[model samples]
Target: MNIGATVVFSVLFLLVTVLGFVAAGWRRGNLDELAEWGLGGRQFGTIVTWFLLGGDLFTAFTVVAIPALAFGAGAVGMFAIPFCIITFPFIFIVFPRLWRVAKQRGYVTVADFVHARYRSKTLALAIAVTGILALMPYIALQLVGLEVAIGALGFDTSGLTGDMPLAVAFAILAAYTYKSGLRAPAMIAIVKDILIYVTVIAAAIIIPGQLGGFEHIFAAIPASKRLLRPPTASGLADYGAYVSIALGSAVATVLYPHAATALLSSKSGNTVRRNMVLLPIYTLLLGFITLLGYMAVAANVRGMPEFAKYFAAYGNNFAVPALFLHFFPSWLAGLAFAAIGIGALVPAAIMSIAAANLYTRNVHLAIVNPRMTALDETRVSKLVAVFVKIGAIAIIFGLPVSYATDLQLLGGIWIIQTLPTVVFGLFGRTFDPRALLIGLFSGLACGTWMVAQQHFKTSVYTLHFDGYAIPLYAAMWALLLNMIVAGALSVPAWMRGAASFTGLSGSGDSLRDEA
Candidate 1:
């Protein structure tokens, strides 16, 4: 192990661990209430919300996988830059209304809003279950990033002994999140974002300088690797896949329960809108981070004897870590690794809390115990948060990282199925609740089948029509099928003039009030 690097990493990790616990008292709220514990009393201002959402969305997965994708798949991996860019407009236009409704209704999760809008407990359950399932693999991906960071520090990460550090790290994460609730991740996110910005800025300046500038870095890459493949007469597979992933991902990004948790925690709808405008700064940071993959390719880190084993073991996931280790001193590398590690923790905490909130509000309370008190609900959520972390750790230990990636792909597909009921519902559209439920089922089943047909190797599926082949995101295809089914069935209900389907509480007035 590099002793100096390990010391720096340890110190930084220790500092955040302390900060996590201290955050319970930061805003001074009653921890026994679900609103206080789950949503930070809906009290976060624009800056805190910015940091929280930034840290929550731009996770360790972003640090490890974006560059890795660029390193392996070339220009196609740069889709994430556009993906981030596309998502914020959706946030700006759609989510502030959601925040207003959630704030007024005391809805803690997307399912809570779904329940009120549709007035169907079953539909709410479907949304809740989908959120939990989608988040499990996402939480596990954080560990994948953390594992790479820890291994980069020169620690063994193979067997039971190698897994102890991950366990210990998550144990601390679970404890603080259970104690401090959303505040833990919200407070730690400030530090996590600073570290990430520092690391990215330093890498931007230092790596290119060492590599003889961006011109030479691009020169080192083959033309095929530097640019996306053009569309051919037979198909637009590459172009379609790029556009579909970007659009599908943009829609799916805000739908994640954790994303909603961050949005609802903000003090006002304007806070969400303001943060949406400022969040693009991270997109610029992402562009810099994505270049690290090309930097790794230029430096030939995989060919280095010291890093060859890591490449063999972790595949492209090690590219960012390997790049840091090669060019920087042990101390600086440690700082970068800590940034990645803490990046994992912030998201992991938020994801667990979000999942827990869903289970407590939508599942446990709605189905299992309608009479559960607020204090009891808060206790259940806290306990569920710990169990959620434990379950995520189990995923990291029991399965291969590829499994987590595959599930996360499906997670996006699964979560986007709720868009009609959640996002469209915000517009005061009155769809038959049963039809919406069927649509949700259709999308989930169709999306899963398409992904399975690809053998879980990719999220894009190709359609062969006449002689031309068209490729698109499975989620988008499934969503189309869902809307078709729901829209068709909803026509009957609309024609009947059923007042029950009109809006929240069977009246369009509540929705129009916000309008």
Candidate 2:
């Protein structure tokens, strides 16, 4: 290890670790309550909410994996930019309503909202189960990001021993998150986001100069690696997969429990609204990140004979780290590495908290003990957070890095099936709980099958109309069929007057007493 890099990384890691522990007391409240522990007492304001959501939504996956995809597959990887652009606007439209209902009903998880709306344990359980499954792989992607960063610093991450440092880092994260709950990530996000901004700005300026310039970087790339669309057999531009991936990801981004956790932690519906307006600035950082991939191509980081075999064994996930180490001095490179590592902690903590909340509310308390106290619920959530972290680490060891990335993608597909019940169900009263259940299961099955048929390589299917192939994302296709079947099934329920059932149609003040 370069001593300068190692020293800087060690100091930064220790500082964040201490901050995590201290966060438990930052906004002192009833720590034994689910609302306090799971949702930060639902009291974050505009800036805090902004940082929390920004840190939660933009993870090491955004910084590392998206660019790695760009590095490897060119334009298809840049799906993330449009994906993010579409997400905030969609969130703006749907989330404030979710915020109003959740605050009013004292709901701590998405399942809580579903249960309040439908009065069906079955429907709530389905959403709870899907959230947990989707979040685990997402948490694992954080580990993947951390591992890539550590490896970039010249650490040996080749086997189980190679993962010991990661194991220790996560253990510390679990400890603080269990102690501080959502507050740990909420506080750490500030530091992580600051480091991320500085690092990205520096890279955008410094890397282009090192590689001659933007034009030279583009010119240096091979034809196969430079196309904005999928290259045809004759090297033509076909953007079918690009458009599908972008739209599919946008629809799915906020469905993650952690993303919802951030929104719910806000002060009011207006806070969520203002955040939707301001969050797109984070997307600009991502443009720099995607550009780093092209710079990696220009620098020959992956193609260089000396480094080729190592990255080939590791997957192109190491592209950004390799580029930084090659071009920057040891100390600055260490800061970038630390940014990626600490960045993982923010989302990892929130995801575990969100997953734990689902289990405690929907599974444990709802199914196992309906009379469970707020303290009991908090206890269960804290313990489950540890197990969730363990599961994420297990995923890292159990799969190839490339395959782990695919699991994160599959998580999106699985979770997006809940949108009809969660997002659309907010506006109207047509969906019967039973119909929603059927639609969710149908979407899960069809979407999983489509993605699996492609051997998990892509999230799209080709539709032939008049001898022309129109590629559609599996999630969108599954959602269309889901809505069709659900609408058809719910018509009978609507005719039976099921739409008149009592649910969460309350106002902001409806929950003031509970608060």
C-alpha lDDT of candidate 1 relative to the true structure: 0.93
Off by over 4 Å in 1: 498-515
Worst 10 residues of 2 by lDDT: 498-507
RMSD of each: 3.3, 4.8
lDDT of 1 by residue, 1-515 (tens): 87878998999999999999999999899999999999999999999999999999999999999999999989988999889999999999998999999888888998988888888999999999999999999999999999999998889999999999999999999989989999999999999999999999999999999999999999998888888777888999589999999899988888999999999999999999999999999999999999999999999888899988888778999999998998888889999999999999999999999999999999999878999999999999999999999999998899987899999999999999999899889998678889999999999999999999999999999999888989999999999999999999999888776454353554568756744
Error of 2 at 206 (Å): 0.8
Regions of candidate 2 where Cα sits further than 4 Å from its true position: 229-237, 498-515
Model 2 / residue 89 / CA error / Å? 1.1
What TM-score would every model get versus the actual structure? 0.96, 0.93
RMSD of 1: 3.3
Model 2 agreement with the true structure over 409-444: per-residue lDDT tens digits? 689889989998898778876698898999999999
Clash count list over all predictions: 0, 0
| Model 1 pairs whose backbones collide | none
TM-score of candidate 1 to 2 decimals: 0.96
Q: Local distance difference test, per candidate?
A: 0.93, 0.87
